[model samples]
Target: MAGQSLGTILGRAFRLRCPKCGGGRMFSGLLRMHDRCSECGLVYERDPGYFLGSSYVNYGFTALTLTPAYVTLHYAFGWTNTQLAFPLVGWVLVFPVFFFRYARALWLGMDVYFDPQSFEDPAESEQPEPPVR
Candidate 1:
């Protein structure tokens, strides 16, 4: 398959589809992900710590949004820090869970976009098996 555009990659990330095929689902349930893409057989976690980088995506998003929200609510709306505490804490706790799938998807999408050739079928890249006796 040809290399995908940025829009295509982001679209697949948002839809939680496999970055390689864009057809196989990234998650089977709310928090359950398939080991690999069913359509393309592309492994979701390339290494033991592959998805660990996804935490940066999640944390980056939360911090970027939370800071702005806190500033706006505290200054523009004259909300007290105590008043904002409960909701912001809830957001911190909840949003990551909700965004988990998208974060992983985005991580995978970025990897595929930057290294498209790495995702090609292993069988195609490897030589034929040796004949049996």
Candidate 2:
């Protein structure tokens, strides 16, 4: 794990593999994720709503990549906003769906990189309980 580089982790993310082992698959279906990694037994979801982070990833990716293209086409190419609107809207809606798995994978990879302890065995690590209010 220490020997792995950022590129390696990102590559694994692009491949949709388990961020830790880079062997087990990250998803079971289009939007369904395997509960844990098959190779390393890493849990995909640390808590309920964990995937909310991935939604932000998906949104940021879509906005960052598409916004520039839209601006370029509209201003430089002289395409009308009406012409760009449909395709841009469709892209914003559709691309996120396609990118869902990758976003989650990337999010997981980022988390694993920043929080190395997340890669620890679940049995060995103690899960923090929610505060009782």
Candidate 3:
């Protein structure tokens, strides 16, 4: 965060790349994230339930999107609640699933940005992997 801009942070996050190095991918698949960065070995989940905060990011974005869409469709388009219910409900269900990875990535990026010290280069002091649950 010292020299990295917001754009760079979001760019790396959106691309699902490692926050520190921007070289390693954060996820190996649609829903599976690597334990550590391949390029820099930065541990992705710093502690237990680390990604739980990402749910806030997901919910916040969903509300922001939903509120405006609901308002616009209801007022401007004169769409009734019934007309909007199905699509909006569907969106509420699916959008979070689709945005799951992104929300986690954004949360990680913001966390790294705000607490750079917490995410220091792992090469300096290797961290033991957490025991498999």
Top-lDDT candidate index: 1
- Look at candidate 1 and give me any clashing residue pairs: none
Find the 10 residues in a row with the least total lDDT in model 3: 117-126
Q: Residue 106 deviation, candidate 2, in Å?
A: 0.5
Error of 3 at 23 (Å): 0.9
Q: Which candidate wins on TM-score? A: 1
What's the TM for model 2? 0.86
> Model 1 Cα RMSD, Å?
4.2
Per-residue lDDT tens digits for candidate 3, residues 1-133, read 2546678889999999988889999989999999999998888998999999999999999999999999999999999999999999999999999999999999999988888767765564577889999
- By TM-score, the better pick of 2 and 3 is 3
- lDDT of the structure predicted as candidate 1: 0.92
Which segments of candidate 2 are over 4 A away from where they belong?
A: 1-3, 122-133
User: What is the C-alpha lDDT profile of model 1 across 71-109, one tens digit per residue?
Assistant: 999999999999999999999999999999999999999
- For candidate 1, the clash count comes to 0
lDDT of 2 by residue, 68-133 (tens): 989899999999999999999999999999999999999999988888774776665777889999
The true-structure Cα RMSD of candidate 3 reads 7.7
Model 2: lDDT of residue 35: 98
Where is model 2 poorest over a 10-residue stretch in terms of lDDT?
A: 117-126
